[model samples]
Target: MGTTSDQTAQHEGSKAAMGGLIVCPVDLDRPGLRVLDSGTGDGYWLQDLLGTYPRLVDGTLVGTDVTAAKFPKHGAPQPISLQIQSITQPWPSEWKHSFDLVHQRLVLGACGSFPHATAVRNLAELVKPGGWIQLIEPDQTCGIQDGPAMRDFIKLVTWVFERMGGHARYAYDVKRWLLDAGVVDVEERSVPNYLGARVPDADLARRTARWTADAMMPLLKYTEGHDGPIPIPREDLQTLVPRLHEELLERGGFYPLRVIYGRVPLAKE
Candidate 1:
């Protein structure tokens, strides 16, 4: 049991179907595939799907992350026979309706547009008739309508997200965007982050540690990357970690997350 960064989201078995470790075979066993991986962090899953997937090595996989250089730093070496492509545009026009599967994850919006839903519409257009689109996302500052952390856990980052025209509340309502984009038979599944998942798995425990460290590192020093304002001070956020950890440990944070997806079942030309 070893830990890998961003390998299948830090959700332990939360992303059981997409997470790293190859605990199970990730083969989609479908035909005529042209996959577009949005937000492909360090190429973890893509590498896994190609090398160990046992079912998709022959299909074409186009990988994209927030940036072209977001490839993962470590993994059990990937396959030699997979197609990889970089995407930097808000959306790709040339690849419309050309894929059997379209995927996006952990995206930050740029402009006021609903990238969450816009991406869905774009991916929908990219999928050949009867294809599928999958999206996964988690918000670090998850809050309920009246939760203790909604506005005061550390500080207000809501304005920060708005400053850059991004959606701070995207996670809770993202699936709405997918449905409006003509994606029928939508299915939404929620996977919360439980400190319990780490209770016995040394690997997951380690990953949890790193994630906590990274979040508390006052990552605000790099606020320039976010746009403006550090939102809550790094010191403030760091201070909350111990309490947050303790609370989650008491019953695992079960942070709300959404994995919403849909299928285009009608055949298209």
Candidate 2:
């Protein structure tokens, strides 16, 4: 887990690159519409969506996570409710086939605790027939021009996540998961999250790099339960932070973010 500041920085970086609250086209005016944001960190994405489509105020909007301490107070015209729930477990029976739009972003790290297929199937079960599901995750396999330190960092982190029963590179498989879960018309859009100081938007890139470095700090200290500590030392991680930034500054250095979405098939389908 990362600090609040680190998460905020990551959100800002993602928002700058992704261009909106979400990439999927939602019909805010649909009757009895309901929206659910699984792993809704700080509720920013849901807030942005509600802010953009004020008409959704009439519908139910819920954000669920393992904790509600970080959810923002909702004074928006439509109330955004926060629920404390874990994505790995089965959702409430009432929630099954209940939402018009289900959104989850950057939850791969947490979802890695369970089988990817099971986690995704649980999310898919929350959508109503013909509703939409949108998932966004970083393609861990696709970092650009990684330096030796960054390379080592990736290797270490990947190993740590796998040891914890999670998949670090799950983003690359999201579309297939949705499809296997019976979603239709699946669509995928990949965006380059430019990092490093040489990109056109260098300020955002720098902040993103810093956030990435900060987020990885915990993994540096992580140890598999019976195995000794992860090989990377704290000092090495500290040194790698600046080195990562420097690497990103080189030409064509960026991370790829993939947004994959699909619609729940209508019953007749």
- Which residue window of length 10 is worst by lDDT in model 1? 17-26
What's the residue-level lDDT of 134 in candidate 2? 91
Segments in model 1 whose C-alpha atoms lie over 4 Å from true places = 1-13, 17-27, 72-90, 108-115, 139-159, 195-199, 216-219, 222-252, 265-269
C-alpha lDDT of all candidate models, in order:
0.53, 0.75
Model 2, 39: alpha-carbon shift in Å?
1.1
What TM-score does model 1 achieve against the real structure? Answer: 0.69
Name model 2 segments beyond 4 Å from true. Answer: 1-6, 29-32, 73-78, 142-144, 224-235, 245-253
What is the model-wide C-alpha lDDT for candidate 1?
0.53
Q: How does each model score on TM-score? A: 0.69, 0.84
Error of 2 at 195 (Å): 2.2
lDDT of 2: 0.75
- Among the numbered candidates, top TM-score falls to 2
Candidate 2: Cα lDDT at 52: 79
Kindly give the number of clashing pairs for every candidate: 4, 1
Local accuracy of candidate 1 as per-residue lDDT tens digits, 43-99: 555665565455666667766554534443443243322223433244556788787
